[model samples]
Target: MAALILILLLALILGGAGFAVHILWWIAVIVAVLWLLGFVFRSAGTGGTRGRWYRW
Candidate 1:
C-alpha cells in the first residue's frame, strides 16, 4: 500500500500534474509515514499481546 502510494507520488511529480500533486502530496506522505510507523512499532504476532486468549 505504502509502496504503491510512493510510486504514484513519484509519477505525479514527474508527470507534471502540478495541481494533483499539490492536493494529494500530503495524503501520500501521511499514508507512507503512518505505514512506516506501524511497521516499526508493530508487535511480533507471537500471541504475547493476547495473553491467555490464544490458550482458550
Candidate 2:
C-alpha cells in the first residue's frame, strides 16, 4: 500500500512539472515575440538619432 502511494505521488509530481514546463515554453515564445517587435519598432532618440527601445 505504501509503495502504491509513493508511485502515485511520483507520477503526480512529474505530471505537474511537465505542465509547468509547457507553460514556461509558451511564456518564452511570447517574450521573444515582444522583443522582436521592440527591435523592429525602436524609437528615435536625441538629435534625430536612432536609439534602442530598451535601456540596456
Report every candidate's CA lDDT.
0.73, 0.97
Residue-wise C-alpha lDDT for candidate 2, range 1-56, written one tens digit per residue: 99999999999999999999999999999999999999889999999998989977
For model 2, what is the C-alpha lDDT against the true structure? 0.97
lDDT of predicted model 1: 0.73
lDDT of model 1, residue 45: 54
| Candidate 2 lDDT for residue 56 | 70
TM-score, candidate 2, is 0.87
Worst 10 residues of 2 by lDDT: 47-56
Q: 1-56 in candidate 1: lDDT tens per residue?
A: 99999999998788777777877998899988987876666655565562222223
Off by over 4 Å in 2: none
**Every model's TM-score:** 0.44, 0.87
TM-score, cand. 1 vs. native? 0.44
